[model samples]
Target: MPFYTYMLHCSDGSYYTGHTDDLEQRISQHHAGNLGGYTKSRRPVRLVWSQEFGERYEALRAERQIKGWSRAKKEALIDRRWDELSRLARSQSQFTLRQAQGERVSIVADAFEAMQSAAQTAHPREACGLLLGEGDCITAALKTRNVHPSPETHFEIDPQALIDAYRSEREGGLRVMGYFHSHPTGSPSPSETDKAMAAHDGKIWAIVADDDVMFWADDKDGFHALSYDVGSG
Candidate 1:
């Protein structure tokens, strides 16, 4: 079975990270205040972000790493500020230059929220959209029809939407910085098909699966995980 690494935004404005096999049930337990420990004292909690992993150890590893994050970095992730989140991730003396390739990518908070909404609305089926904003920051998410027949496992953005996006960009609207899609019942990380379809042109790919949202930078070398920051659009 799949495992999950999650973060809860507690009433005390603190973050709690954990791992589980059943995300909804686990979260419901937290909501009911029955899962004792730190969150019990914090009371009312909300899930801010989560990532799905195919392995229990992966989920555990992610939980441990997130638990070590400073409040600012966690908030950066909660806010979907990729650049700031990433810079901070590499800011620590212990961190190395291994995180270099994912430099020019980010998504505004409002945009991420929009993406989440779209993903949920199309649950059990993939949702696809365009990411738009100024420079390297994505400020908005525009949902488009998934023209593919098998949306549950595949997604194809409407061609007209792409055309319209380019046209608007040419006419001076928010540039189409990248695109986002939901995995519905899979990992947020790129799948084999995703990797195969990537154009490797330095575009940002924000994949939403379950409650977790992750950003990646696409290039010839492959997908480089990129951090995202949430911001008011």
Candidate 2:
């Protein structure tokens, strides 16, 4: 039986590499997001590269090797540019490092301004909202009423607004990709309450503190700071 090493392009514009004996079934699991771990949340992953091996060990070794490669090297492999691969390998030590601020995720300028504006006026109190867009991009911000009892600190988005946004997504409107909230007196980093309350359901959270707004990816492991562009469109 042949084993395979495969690569998937995740929705966040990152890559996932794996080894499997059944390529078709493994990819199906990834698509279903049933495979879990890194690929679980970065769904709609599409298989971009795969190579069959006579033995499982060979496939495993290749998978391990590819996992350590830079994105450029991986893309070269996908495009089958062997010469470029060698050049990329050599360049890694000096110049091929992944950009510190990744361009994978994006939020529209209007959405960002809306969030900032809402938070500014709500100073001394918290502001909350929902992010609507498609596939790792936030195109709109739906400012929702904060219903938390202690408005100066905690914030809870109005439940009915959440329900309505979800209903709209079902009807082919913008997707509810994530949520946002303000940290009236501190940094945009997640607080203890956020860690405890957020579901870690693979949603992005935009946190605003003062004039600075930052993006975070909430996952089972923890909150990960994700660099994002505020696109103008």
Candidate 3:
């Protein structure tokens, strides 16, 4: 018999996770309040997501994993937003690493070098790209077109490039860790315009100016400087 891992959207806007051998019977019990546990009180529960597993242990493990995820991560799973799920996972990992290491960031040495080269090549015109990787390390930098009206002092990553990156990520490519941009005549820092236009979604941002590069975190409070170490990734 097949085992299943399932998640329910409770009436109180919370989620409940479980594993069962008979998926239909288990959901019926929850709906009827026959099982007197967490879901019993949160009646009118709706089955939001489920996955089949060959073994009971596999289903049980999946149940436990979902139980530990944050609400945003859970919603991502329920909605099948694979790209968002990858980004949220990386953000969570980055948060924990920041707390443990005094807010330092890591990037692959090759990624950093690539960004520098791209920026220099686009001199006088801002260079822009997407930073791709898993967890907290930036492993790749994909140069993208700067579609802003005045490319010399501004940048806008081509919308199609952004879309394709997320699609590739859903197909098991590296996660979109963050972004990189250049300021040909200014310091490697967030311009006032950059702050005004940021999504502030807790992703890393790298600013390259001349031969120097600086990293920052576009978090809820605002952009803050981050020290970094180059690694093999």
Candidate 4:
């Protein structure tokens, strides 16, 4: 079919739903600075859920229904946990794990460099990657591409690559610490969409960059800059 619907799990962990005719091409536009709106400033969005339909009206109806769902309900949809969705529907509140503490400068710089290299290679749009590290020491950098960019930008990391890297790291006792992405023509600051997408847990550190870089830890104040060399412990 000519119609497609997609769900985006923003940095804040919230869900954004939309429909398009050209699934892959529409997502590219979102990341290429072509579609500028709510997701414009939120440059790097991840596709957590998607489905195809034969009709545009059906896709739109689905999107509207999903938009009104509770957070837990939305997450269940993203995770495809249909069973738990009903239980979550009865709960009044939700809780998420806390993100880990902030990291050191050396690690952040290493991540920035990796993202910069990706950007250069993918020029005109943007490049993305993940940094696997211990408490604060970067152990490995896994590079990926923004393969789908439309109603929003979605990343694609090689599963085998990530699995191999993770297994190797765990064998040595390290951890998959944080993630980083580049914005082709935007600022590093987290936009409203970023805040909405952010996971409450402090484990995920979102590093956004244009020409410059800004890193934000999960906190009530939202994303703030981590001075290039002032290591936060």
lDDT of each: 0.80, 0.81, 0.84, 0.58
Expressed as tens digits, the lDDT of each residue in 1-233 for candidate 4 is 67987977544333456789998988887767587744555557777788898998888767655553555677887788978886775542221112233533334333443554565455556555666766655544567645544313434455665677678767885576656665655566566655686665554454444334555566566654442331111
Q: How much is 53 displaced in model 2, in angstroms?
A: 55
- TM-scores for all candidates: the values are 0.60, 0.57, 0.56, 0.44
Clashes of each: 14, 0, 0, 20
Q: Candidate 1 lDDT, tens digit per residue, 1-114?
A: 999989998775556778899999999999998977567767699999998999998997777566545567888887899999988967843333555644745555556656
The TM-score of predicted model 1 comes to: 0.60
| Residue-wise C-alpha lDDT for candidate 3, range 54-92, written one tens digit per residue | 999898778755654666788999999999999998986
RMSD over all Cα atoms, model 3: 19.0
**Which candidate has the highest TM-score of all?**
1
The positional error of residue 62 in candidate 2, measured at the CA in angstroms, is: 42
In candidate 4, what residue range of length 10 has the lowest lDDT sum? 92-101
Best by lDDT: 3
**Candidate 3's error at 101, in angstroms?**
6.1
Q: Which ranking of candidates, highest lDDT first? A: 3, 2, 1, 4
Comparing 1 and 3 on TM-score, the stronger one: 1
Cα lDDT over the full model 1: 0.80
lDDT of 2 by residue, 104-209 (tens): 4677666876786677667779999999998777899888999999989899999999999999999999999999999988788899999989898988898987
Error of 2 at 51 (Å): 52
Clashing pairs in 3: none
Superposed Cα RMSD, model 1: 12.6
